[model samples]
Target: MLIGYARVSTLEQNEDLQVDALKAAGCDRWYVDHASGAKASRPQLDKMFELLREGDVLVVWKLDRLGRSVQNLIELINRLHKMGVGFKSLTEQMDTTTPGGTLVFNVYASMAQFERDLIRERTNAGLRAARERGRVGGRPSKLTHDDEVMIRQLYESRTVTVRQIADRFSVSRGTIYRAIEAGGVAQTEN
Candidate 1:
């Protein structure tokens, strides 16, 4: 059985073209979704998956209509394969039930992996360059070194309570405790 799936980004878009294509492709049953391809949840698509059985072929008007990204498309296709089901995309002319189609899909998978590797390499290089320039990522410390030193002194003198120190620094008691701890001050009941 060729169960078709079609999707449009919005309800305003017409699905007639996709419907016609699916019908012409000999789809036995079809489902339509009026949701963004980026969205993981689609009621009609979920329903179609639930109804799919082994030996069933999932058909779509276009590959993009069925997945958000190349990685997502690969995952969906792999999932269908694992279930003993096949996949076909009308626009891309891809059919996992055929040997040639499987080879093409594998090429797509490799390309997606290569793209991911390139992105990771660029990001790491950027991070390294930023570090060389003395630039660090993450939120700046709320308390400065001088502030931590003062907090440690106040805490050690025992003249002010931890609560008082926290109020003076306009920070939480936990922050004050951390500052004192950094200065080798043994924690005591406040």
Candidate 2:
């Protein structure tokens, strides 16, 4: 049984092209996903996987129609293969049931891995560059060293409220509380 999966990235994009190709390829049943956006769920894809059996083959008009990322594609294909089902891509002429097709799939998996490696390497290099340039990746402190000393002085004097200190520094009362705690200053309701 050939079960076809059709997808469109957004609600605005129609699945007609994929549906026509899948129907032409003699798909017995169709699973359509009008994905719309990144956060949207694909109930049809999940239902199709659940309906697939040992002898069932999953077909797609294009490789990317099944997955947005290579890692995701490889995982899905591997899962289908383990379940004794085959996969075929209409446009790419890839069929996992044949030896040559298996080789092509392996090549694709390798390419996906290569792409992942490149991304990781680039990210690590960028982080190292940022570190060398002395740019740390967290929020800047609201209080400078001079401000810290003044906070300690004003807080110890107990002449002003924490809310007052917070207002003076344009920060939240929690920030004032945190500064006091960090400096091991005794906390009291102000």
Candidate 3:
């Protein structure tokens, strides 16, 4: 049995290319998801893993689409191999059933890890430079002190509902609640 897996990081991304490639590759069954690789849980990936069995072949459009990290990808592939399942990545020309293909997969995996490490290194360096320049990181405050005061006053008066308060502040109810919980607003005595 040949099972295909396709994924796109977001809904805005089109899966047509991967889907077409998988179909052309003669996939008998397939799964797909529109979810970020950073997310640990993906419904379609979970389903595909569950449905795969011994002697079955799992095909993917690309390896990165299957996993975000080299460790995770290695673990997944090793698990499948142990289960007597075969794997293939169309774009990478990787296949688990052959020795040469396995070597290629390993090399690509190492390269992927290296690429990720470089990205992290560059990001940290950039942040350090920005900090050295006296630039602050993270999001600016959504509400000013004046806004907090007004929010507290409104909440104490009980003239407007929490939802109304959130609307007036242009923030979510959860954000409003967090502000109140974090002592952003004055507390009213019961």
Candidate 4:
């Protein structure tokens, strides 16, 4: 059985092309999802995976239709292979059931890995450059140590509720609560 999976990033996008291709390729069953590839969760894909059985083949219009990252695509392929299921990509002409297809899969896998490494290297370089310029990265701390101490004192005195204290410190109530939670006995002393 050849099962097809199709995905598009937006709800408004059409799955016609993918669906037609899958059907033309003789897919026994098809699953479609309209969701961002960046997200890990996809209900339709999960269901399709559950329905998969040994000797079944999974087909897709392209690689990105299956996963956002090369590592993720490779992982999914490996898992399906271990389950005695096969994989086929129309655009890439890759079918994991034959030696020729396996060779193509490996070649694609190598390219994907290379692409990931290049992205990582560029990101690291960018971060290093930003650090050298003294441009601090990440969110600024909501409060300094002294501010936390004062917040604890105010909490202990019962002068203000958590929300009121958060407003006073220009932080979230959760932040104030976390500070109190982390302070332990020190908060009560304050």
Candidate with top TM-score is 1
* TM-score (C-alpha) between model 1 and the true structure: 0.77
- Tens digits of lDDT, candidate 3, 26-85: 999889999999888899999998989999999999988888778788878988989899
Task: Check candidate 4 and list the clashing pairs.
Answer: none
> Top lDDT: which candidate number?
1
At residue 179, what lDDT does model 4 achieve?
A: 83
Angstrom error of the Cα, residue 162, model 1: value is 14
Candidate 2 per-residue lDDT, tens place, 77-157, comes to: 999999999999999999998999999999999998999999999999998999999988769998997888788788999
Candidates by lDDT, descending order:
1, 4, 2, 3
Q: Find the 10 residues in a row with the least total lDDT in model 1.
A: 137-146
lDDT for residue 79 in candidate 2, whole number 0-100: 92
What TM-scores do the predictions have? 0.77, 0.71, 0.60, 0.73
Candidate 3 segments whose C-alpha is farther than 4 A from its true place: 1-50, 60-79, 181-190
Candidate 2 residues lying further than 4 Å off, grouped into runs, are 37-40, 139-190
Please give the lDDT score at residue 9 for candidate 2.
76
Model 4 misses residue 127 by how many Å?
3.4
Off by over 4 Å in 1: 139-190
What value does the lDDT take at residue 12 in candidate 4? 96
